[model samples]
Target: MTARPAKAVSRRPPRPARRTSAVRPPRAGRGGPRRLYSRVRRAWDRPLTAYYLILGGSLLITVLGLVMVYSASQIKALQSGLAPSYFFRKQLLAAAIGGVLLLAASRMTAKLHRAMAYPLLAVSVFLMCLVQIPGIGVAVNGNRNWLSLGGPFQMQPSEFGKLALVLWGADLLARKQERKLLTQWKHLLVPLVPVAFLLLGLIMLGGDMGTAIILTAVLFGLLWLAGAPTRLFTGVLGGAVAIGALLILTSANRMSRLACIGATDPGPGDQCWQAVHGIYALASGGFFGSGLGASMEKWGELPEPHTDFIFAITGEELGLAGTLSVLALFAALGYAGIRVAGRTEDPFVRYAAGGVTTWVMAQAMINMGAVLGLLPIAGVPLPLFSYGGSALLPTMFAIGLLIAFARDEPAARAALALATRKPVFGRKPAGVRWKTMRRRVARRPSGER
Candidate 1:
């Protein structure tokens, strides 16, 4: 009976062998650096990332600048027998007006921007020409780059020149590109380079080499963005350098500035006084700085503590951490600008964004480099971080331009539309909820009300 039962074995197939050598995919969020990189990539890939970066970075820089201006200018204002908040109030007012301009610029269409380009260029040129006239031009710190707007109000046409160049150059390049004329080096450099050099001449005539340098950077940025050939780009660059060197060599003041680079001593007539003190302020700042408004350099020790050397005062009061934060903000703003330029299909947006980024970044580097004693003192105010209303106004408007371009990105536009469609997160839109409630009420029995 047992043998008979054994002969009746089941016909089920043999169990398949498990493949022990098979590799398993790594789990999500398990690998350390890979996970972090993925997260960063995702965040960077978000539609509104560049927009938020531009908006948040610019706002933070501006707000922090206002705070620093108030802090750094208090001593200077009191020394001049004015209220401590005088400069602060003026800057705040300019910021407010600039906010309105920024809003208007951001809301305008691309066509409107292109339309305004010529008008803005005209106004800027008119003002720049006006700066050459002694009666209307106001000289500050030995540079005749400002226009007296009557009373205490002053405007720097060169500051506006930066914006004008960005807009006009962008529009010019975009149009030429559409016409397929950028292939020839002549068409690329013709009006653009000549006009830029003209602006540089105007800026230099006012003895504002700093502004000239920034404008030069913007010019080159435009040319490069327009895809200028290597030889042409280098030729233009060489000409600029030679011109800059000639100017520096010819002037006593410029020579003095050139000699002050990396100087450790005050030298004769305290020529290096500002530079040395700037180093002192930064070195004394240690890691975290003394505290807000606690800078010793601002108490008559440092020159232009609220403008050219503002970074030094910031170093003294806020320390390395604060300075790094400012640097990071600028870096983020620049990176965002580059991202916007890179992602845009529109040539105007690309050129405009790149030009603006180059302008701001070049200026920041110059100011910071001068403060750090790494370069000659260029007498340029730190963009957004300085106390001058003229500088702040134009820079803020430029920031608005960046925001506008960032908003114009296809992904950014979609994100903005979705955001407007649903203003709140994690909940149905109010309109949708309201409609649903009305439908439910209409479907209910009268007694169920």
Candidate 2:
């Protein structure tokens, strides 16, 4: 009876029954993958994303290359009875000079770029021709691609030829497109393809198959962006491949390199020495690497550890992580260049960006491929990530071209203008030209308002 009375005294409302269904509304901003995807899309959609990516990626690669260069070149320099900092200092000076060129290029208008195209081409062709002369041309590692400036400094006209081809080809295509000539396949291939082959011919004369390959990539990129017909593109590609194979077969040196692809031994006369050593360097570099300046491969074990084989040295010193970081940076730069090319309304900008991207990406792939034993060692330095000043300068200038194109985008221009308007120095914040406003207000009595 007491228990019944106590139960009856309880007057609280019963709790709502729990639903058996497990489904529930998604929490706001709680969609893990979808939210991440949305955030990434927003970030990529920003107007200045490409500009920042191009600038930041190039700078990072250059800076990292400098460090790697110094580290990798020290022993080589010492063995040569030179200062350990010799290569580093030279590369640093080139980077400094290249910075000026980049700034100038990034500031130039598209019209200015077009105007300089012919002049640049002429200069590059002249220099490349000079590289063929017996006394004037300096031969390095059996490739007569270097020109001595005076004492220790040398230049590679082939590198400049790459930039020239991009600019000249872009201008040529842009003009043809403006004249409505690209619709005809002949116009698309005529001068551009012919001129590119001419440059390739010059590079091949220097025994630089690698540079020729890159130039070919730039040519194809230009044609592709110009909307070449499938048949035309394939015909051109097949012809280039045939020519390349024929050239490789004829040269004992080139054939030797081809034979070294994926080689594990040094072969007769140590023909595959560099290739096998490169693999050894990479294999020695485990996940995190042996640590910076700690690579055994750099200590006389690997040739050109700071140039063509720098990627292997990088792997040995900084490990797989460092190599991947370099790759990611290149990928970001390439993606940004494509974005610039895709987003631009200007024909010149589109073609130029695409060509430059192709040149750099193709060169990078070839260099890294050789290092990884997937390709024949082409003796081409890693763009912006190797020791050679000749490679670094032109590559940096190309990067600057991407920056200029990115900045030329309407949205990017607006964003840049807005950024410049922000207050800095001792100046007041935006919307408040405090001093000037105060002076104007003070000059006009309060009652005047």
Candidate 3:
């Protein structure tokens, strides 16, 4: 019995240990997950559709500006006993500064910009007031609208005023929309009318009719976007026309300027001297142009060649073809800006974009119209191409804002990726590999469960 018991106790080589499945770490060299993740991130950071149009238009205008600046300033510089590059140098410097501002503006967040709206408006108002102070404001070309800080550095509050009004209007409308209170005129008028009148009044005090008109256009565009009542807007428009007409009629200078709008021979020493010369410049440059730097009108004939009359310089140098090209550039800008407003899903962003676009396009049309004698001279400079620091800087910043909105467009983002073909961030994520595991789980028998 003992022998049998001992034999039974003999350990059978611990029944060859039952094998159990062990979870294995992910396979090596399978970078498929990492690669897939990167692809997605790159797509998300891409820009929107309107960006290309803006970029292209900006480049063309800048190049044309450089050429026109040289052409327009050659005679003025020589006459002033300064270097032949005087105006060109100043223009280039302004363009450089404006370009920096433009880039910086493009990177700003919409929220940050909206926050800045009120402060900016306040500052602009203060500046506008400063321009009225006896010694502080310098009268230039019969308009007491400029504040000369120092050598070639002047401050035109009206230029910044346009931006302020836009941002303010957008902020106001956005707040109203948020509270569901924008439907009534009272709610809208509380913030809109007073601010607009204040802005318009300030510019009017300086006798800057051009800036005032642009401001009015911006206001109308914003109100339309804000869904204001049609009757209210029509009333506002009619009132604006009446007030403008009264102002023009009351001022001797303005009256004379208006009377000369279509006069062929303004006669010597008339208020129409500048307008007449502008036409002469355009007429001299038929289709092709007189050739770059060969403008006869810039020789003390066309006053303000580098400022309010820059478009005439373009015609004198680049000719009708060049003028048309300039127009095309502006058209491109309008198209891109309109596209940004259309594509944005956010209401504040859309209104802001539209307002900025309308400001520039309207201003451009006004400047061109004045040059063509289709409208009274408003003293507005052409965007980017004009050689004024104040106008150029704000305009460039506005363009940058438009570009920022365009960058947010979906198609532009996609195109950015396609063009660069590089990841904007570190890498995108690869989807989890659950298919194989799911199949394995399904294969398990119900009994096992």
Using lDDT as the measure, the top candidate is 2
> Distance from true position, residue 135, model 1, in Å?
1.7
Tens-digit lDDT track of model 3 for 43-99: 533454368678779868976887787878888888889899988887788889988
TM-score of 2: 0.89
Runs in model 2 with CA error above 4 Å?
Answer: 1-31, 424-449
Superior candidate under lDDT, 1 versus 3: 1
lDDT of model number 2: 0.91
lDDT of 1 by residue, 33-104 (tens): 889998999999998999999999988998999999999999999999999999999999988998898888
Worst 10 residues of 2 by lDDT: 437-446
lDDT tens readout by residue for model 2, 1-449: 45544455667889999989888888867869878988999999999999999999999999999999999999999999999999999999999998998998899899998998999999999999999998999998888988999989899999999999999999999999899999998899888888898899999998889889888899999989999999999999999999998998899999999999999999989999999999999999999999999989888988899899999999998999999999999999999999999989899999999999999999999999999999998888899889988888888888889999999999999878756654469665644333453332222434442
Per-residue lDDT value at 25 in model 1: 85
Rank by TM-score (best first): 2, 1, 3
Candidate 3: regions farther than 4 A off: 1-48, 414-449
